[model samples]
Target: MASSAASVLNRLLQNASRPKKPSQPPPSPSLILHHINSNNFAAAFSALFSIPTPLSIPLYSRLLRISASTRSLVDARHLESHIISTHHPRHPPTFLLNRTIETYAACGSLRDARELFDEMPRRNGGTWNAIISAYASAGHSHDAILLFSRMNKSGSSRPNDVSFACALGSCADLLALLLARQIHCLVLKYGFAKNVILSTSVVDVYGKCGIMSDARKVFDEMRERNAVSWNVIVRRYLEMNEGEEAVILFFTMIVDGVRPLNFTVSNALVACSDVSALKEGCQIHGIAVKLGFDGDHVVENSLMEMYAKNGLLEDARKLFDDSTSRDVVSWTSIISGYALCGRFAEAEKLFDSMPERNVVSWNAMLAGYVRCLCWGKALDFIFLMAKESEEMDNVSLKLILNVCAGVSDLELGKQVHGFVFRHGFCSNIFIGNALVDMYGKCGNLRSAELWFLSMASNRDKISWNALISGYTRHGRSEEALNAFGEMQWETTPNEFTCSTALAACANIFVLRHGKQIHAHMIRNDFNMDVIIQGALVDMYCKCRSIEYAINVFEQATSKDIILWNSMIMGCAYNGRGEFGLELFEMMLKDGTKADNVTFIAILLACITEGYVDLGHRYFNLMSDEFGIIPRVEHYECMIELLGKHGFMVELEDFIERMPFEPTTPMWMRIFDCCREHSYARLGERAERWINESNPLNPVEFNVCSGPAMEPS
Candidate 1:
């Protein structure tokens, strides 16, 4: 069969090069058309070229239709060349010439179509639409838009619905919202706004541009809509991460009794997955089954992803096991589920056993390792993936950068940055943000700032967040605040920006900056979420504004454990232990569950207030009631509590009974307490421990446990 195909192709090439006289008189146009209708285009083309008579424009136009239907570039080229050679058209040949252009475009030779279009003696509306549609269909969006604008300026012809639809499609591709609006007004001016096809195109462009308000307005005003219209709006919402809106539209479509398409079900499922709305996802699944689309490949894949992302992994795994139509997407969906759940061992086994792997599948396993925080393993697997040369996409690159940030692997991050540049991914805003985050996290703020500045035009909120968070992480609080200020010039800061900026303010005691950010949030209605409330409390407390901290803490309509913990710790730091203890008791009475962090704050209060007995009781409650393990910080607080009260024997005994070796900070805390109480014996032990633990202990010191004062 291979050899036979080779022989046939050789003959076709030979025929293309040499024109032999038809051994018989040129077949009648009817007979030649019979060959074309039978799809014997080669024979039909040869006979048409051999015709001895000049053809009518109608006959030539009919022949161009057949060639367009064939979608054969070679046949289209031959037909055009033969027509050019015959020079058969008399005057105003635009009708037949327009079809030749359409035929050339349909055959995927826009270059040839364009040249012919430009050479036309005179072009009509049909001629302009044909070329515009050709450019639109070929994905030459900019050129299509340019030509569409030219058509209006040249006044060569008035554009009908078809021409507007083509130009609107180009605007959709480029996300040219302003241009789309202009075309939309023209659509109204030309009295084509009611045409369903043209109306649908306007809706599609508005949706793709992410102007949902306009999209909905147009849709509501539509005298009619098809399934394509419904699908476009829902899909655009999902793409823009407006999942709730997508789901609302999906339900609206159903209530309108528009029979759900397979893709409609798929889009609804995607919305459900994104928002983790499991109930809605299951509803869509049932809809698919009811519509007999349950067996559809796309719906089944969407179901798998939906179930996995919503934490129904067992259901997803069961579906994967029962599915007979497993493709790369099916496998990847299941693997990503396992990764999301932090079950890397199972994810890896399934990934290795899959019959085929694409970049998505590879990224799934790599992401699993990163999500599980197995950084070293993730680093190793990425290197393994490099061996396969799986074309790393932005998702994979971001995951790898995340691993670099996780382990603070600057060298590896630089290598991946090179890979991003080599593959022309640096211009992608998401990847650029990831690069900034990676460099910032690796403690290289200069590189992060440089990258941020370089992408000045494209940077979004996430980009500014990355640089601000990086500065805060490395103790460059002033820089972090400055970046936040500058960010206001380009883009408004969101919760993440405010959170980090507040932290920087807290670090440097910049109460003025913290207050300004708070006012800005109020003005923007940034909706003082729980995280913001917590940061506000910590910031005020750190800046020695206890009254303001208390005011914000009490005014919060709802308080989570983190907010309670922050207020309590702030009180302890500012010598307000009594008030902090009162807040803790109120927290318990409020039925807020205290975790390990809450216990840490309470213990700090105990240490500051010198409540020796209360500190011991809370330490016991950590294990007895809350099942919280007593971490080293809790133990250090206990030592300080005992030493400050001059319970020297108990402090010594407590240190001896500790479950683990004390850290340097613990020894230093014990040393400070013992020096204040003039307890020499314990002070000596702490000095030796500090020296052994951190050989570089640099503070000039002696047993400032000061000479032992005789007991009373």
Candidate 2:
């Protein structure tokens, strides 16, 4: 294609090398004028050379009046008077001047066009139209409109199709829809609506001005329609997000047997991506292949992005691989696909191999790393991006800062905060939210609150959720509830906020407030979420209402393992040992496998209820049946169970065989049992273990047995 264009240019330059006529005689005045006005350039060239004499030459002036093409080929700047002396010496010179200006205007030399227009011996309607169209075509709409108004003020000829088109184009460029309407009315008044070129230009103008309805009205009124007219309307609809309409219009064009152009098909396919119209997108793809436009880069890029965005990664990859000439945008689309599909390693490898990269390339890499949970790597990439002179704008900063929050990196978070302040991006809403989340995730509520208060705008649900959840996770239950109360005044809490606040409620044991929240959930129709319902059940159980917890648990429509665990643990902790055991058995019967925490609660319940036999059964079942390994707390519960039963010899033997050394509390439990049963030999052994292992007194000991302090 490059060589073809160059060859075309070479031929044009070669045609300019013809030898000039030498001492040619001039032709008859009428004959020369006829030759110049003729449309055929070769015929006019021959007639100009047939002149008989040079001294009495009147042909040059006649030639000037003939054709714009002949005058363009001439180098007669010094022979101007001879031509003028013969032709129209007595007539008004406005026609010749207008012709000269129009010639330059058509040749796209706007400066020369303007110069000729200004230096004309006289100005007229044709001259103003020429200059206005020239300015409009050059994207100098203001100059075009100014000259147009001047023509009207001078009472020159009213605008024809050519003049109206220029004026309307200026209105479109400026988005002056009102001015465009006025031009439309004037064009209608002049009965130029039948002119297909004028009508198409007006449709294009209206479409650009966002008045698609008017554009359609003009389009339907046209007696003759061209491919350009169809493309303009289709593009307008696509831009408006009316993808369905765009597709419908495209098929209508096809049904009318109008072959869809590359741009028209591209517009329709691009619209499919916006609405996720997969069927329509496929149809457009099929049409493109049939029309041989599937190979066009623009159409192919849009197809790749469309399929990628619609969760069709494999299909998108297939299209990308099939592409013959992939540009940077092509690579960006495929990389974004891999990132979105959670294939970060592949995305990163492909990004590294790209021959060249742009801003989109950097952003894609950063976003990919963050999405893959590699926050440290994301931050590293951010520094490299800055060194390469890629500006970290608000979107980039927000992505990296969110990664910081996820990783809970306080040092990196603080440095990013400073970067935000220095770069004047502190006020961006997304960046501010990310900052709040970062401090919250790092267990720094003080910093989080400070940043939250500094935000000028009202908080969104994400902001409130982050603040509330931060407090709950850090054991600041009272503050979490207070933030929840404040958030209610600003915005309604969603299920996530309610669940988080319920967690705080369980910690504080504020039964009154918890009941009120439960009532609010019922009133606001938030009782349907299984997670929130489970939270409500847990909150009720923590507040020491076993019956209410059971009621809420029973009413929950979809009970998951979390709900079952919450109920089991609630019963265990609140002294409903029999009920807790029954619930555990029911959970197993219902095929809900209890996890380690659930088994711990079950064993603790057995110890509290003096069910030593049941505790042994579960301990063995935990290891053998469920294949669950016991942690330290599980061991503690077993010791408590044995010590409560006064099984000293068995407890000692069990402790000796343990994987980890027993803590002082485990021996203390045994010591208290010895004191209760008056076993002096066991008490002496406990005392010796305490005195020799650590001279310092243990902070806590069983109340039943302990030596008194020597002095204060």
Candidate with the greatest TM-score versus the true structure: 1
Who wins the lDDT comparison?
A: 1
lDDT of each: 0.88, 0.78
Candidate 1, residues 1-712, lDDT tens digits: the string is 9999999999999999998777755578887768867978678778886676656777677777777887878777776776766774544367767888999999889999999998787899999899999999999999999989999889879998878999999999999999999999999998986798888888889989878888889988998888888888889889889999899999999889898788988999989999999999998888888989888999999999999999999999988998988999999999999987888888888988999999999888888888779998898998899997667899999999999999999999999999899999988988999999999999999899899889978989999999999999999999899888988888889998999999999999999999999899888888787889999999999999988899999989999999999999999988899899999999999999999998888988988888889989999999998899888778877887887787877887898999887788788887887777777777777878787767785432354545664345
| Regions more than 4 Å wrong, model 2 | 1-320, 325-344, 358-389, 585-594, 608-611, 621-628, 644-650, 663-694, 698-712
Model 1 — TM-score against the truth? 0.90
lDDT of 2 by residue, 467-569 (tens): 8998998999999999989998888888898899999999989988888878887899874578987898889889998889999888877778888888888
Clashing residue pairs, candidate 1?
Answer: none
Locate the minimum summed-lDDT window of 10 residues in model 1: 697-706
